[model samples]
Target: MAALQTPKFVYMNGGLTAWEDARLHIGCESVTRGLSIFEGIKGYWQPDGSFALLMLRLHFARLKRSAMLLHIPFEHDFDEFSAAIFELMTALVEPSRDMWIRTTLYVVEGHWGENTRSDLVLTAYHQDKALPEPVSLGISTWRQPGDDSLPARIKASANYQNSRMARIEAREQGLDDMVMLNQAGRVAEASTAALMMVRDGVISTPPASESTLESLTADFCEQLAIDRGYRFERRPIDRTELLIADELAIGGTLNEITPVKAIGRRELATDTGMLATLRSDYFASVRGGKPHPFAELTTLPKVSA
Candidate 1:
């Protein structure tokens, strides 16, 4: 894939700013302490010369929950934030390609222990929808932070250090990604996505209680499976279970649906028809080929011809 082009504009603190000029102080808590909450929303290009933001409301809802959990002050309500997102998309998004819109709420001033002001930043760039080939995964030595420590439920920037370390370990091992287990020795998730295992036609995934992010994409796919008459279960999965599963995959907003060809050195059956069907159905649903029950399609304003 080619490198992504930077967007010309970014929405910052209730107004539009040139991307190069959007900046914060070097000593800001967000910079020094990684104190920020964020969300990745995909905007699918439609045939009508517009783009539709998938799960816009749900992403914002998760952002709000993250803010509350982390004690970050978010002054703008849903309507205000939604309007700002649309404004940003209008300025940066094009109908010819899909885009990944990222919104971040971060501390702008003050030290770690003090009350700090927060700013909202929204930026977007084009993204390709093509799915990559099935990947190999290895279990990382790093364990996901439990709720008692740094909770994985909140989309905080600080939580990514754990993911980053595991990803680096995977790269060193010549694997695509790593599956992180919780402190309790159960499967948590992949470096940046939720893990799912299929066996005997049953789709199983670890619940949010298992030190994993409450993934919107994972939930959407689970719903798709249930609607298609596939039995879906959310429970603690053992490490050995992944090695013997009929199929494995990871799901996220960025990684829509990715099949796992192997775990560690053990290669599993990757030719299952179930994974392909889910991947196809997922892309179709997001691109408006079918109705989406959970996410409301917020269409961007049409650009003048």
Candidate 2:
């Protein structure tokens, strides 16, 4: 895993600023009550040695939508936010660096039912670490809430506590990660990533309506599958589906395409599978080694090193 080494700069509140200078009051409602929404985005090093942010437009859209859902009162328009992020990415001395960016909007001055003040904080860091492949997984006892209970599509910081608990339990169980189910006893998603499985050469996953977060990576994979003539479907998945899946993998910005080697002694074939092919192609697309339609919208030209 990549350890955070504080970068020299950050964009906080209203402008580009010093990283160390950004601060939040200890007693602020957003800080104390977990009233915030954020997005995690990955930027890759292109073959031309310039950096290209993966799915930048989609990520910004989600961030704004999440803010709206949570009533965080984010004021900047998409163009403004995009320009700020592009400026930050170009300011890096190493243009070929792979990096992670997080943009957050939260309430800072509200109590209970009072009027709230909001702010934005953007922090980015070099992401040189590569996660290990063929990760082990365990099913968590924690059930993810459906949309009726909470907005499952919003990227709210408070919503992550559910995943955190599942992660803790997975650690205790000697697993790399955990899979969560929805209230209807249907497979939802992994703690931090979207889940996909293969059975009889067909790729299938639970739909977002089944309480899974709308996953950009998963959607990308689905399109990739369709374009390449591979079978893919979005439908309700049950717990028993995991046991019978011929192959399994998780998708996310950070996790990317990680094959599941085993799930509670039910070993999965990972050496040669459809997921392996998709993973390679996905990585190539992100790094600009292959043609991907989304790249045109997702990447911005680096103006300076």
Write candidate 1's Cα lDDT for 1-305 as tens digits. 26767789999968999988999889899888889999999888755555788898899999999988988888888889889988988887654667888899979976765777899999888876566579999999999999988999999989989899999998899999999999999999999999999877888999999999999988898888877888889999998898888889999988878889888888876656676678788877888788668756788766521
What lDDT does each candidate get?
0.86, 0.83
How does candidate 2 fare on TM-score?
0.92
lDDT digits (tens) for residues 1-305 of candidate 2: 45668888887767778888878999887779988888888877677666677887888888888877777677788788888787776665365457888888868887873777888777888865365478899889999997977767998887788899999999999999999999999899999999999998999988989998899999899988877789999999989889888999999988889999998889988868888888888887887889688644356554534
Model 2 clash tally? 0
Query: Candidate 2: minimum summed lDDT over ten consecutive residues — where?
Result: 296-305
Cα lDDT of model 2 overall? 0.83
Q: How does each model score on TM-score?
A: 0.94, 0.92
Candidate 1 residues lying further than 4 Å off, grouped into runs, are 1-4, 269-271
After superposition, the stretches of candidate 2 with alpha carbons farther than 4 Å from their true spots are 1-3, 93-96, 112-114, 129-132, 295-305
Q: Which candidate number would show the highest TM-score if scored against the true structure? A: 1
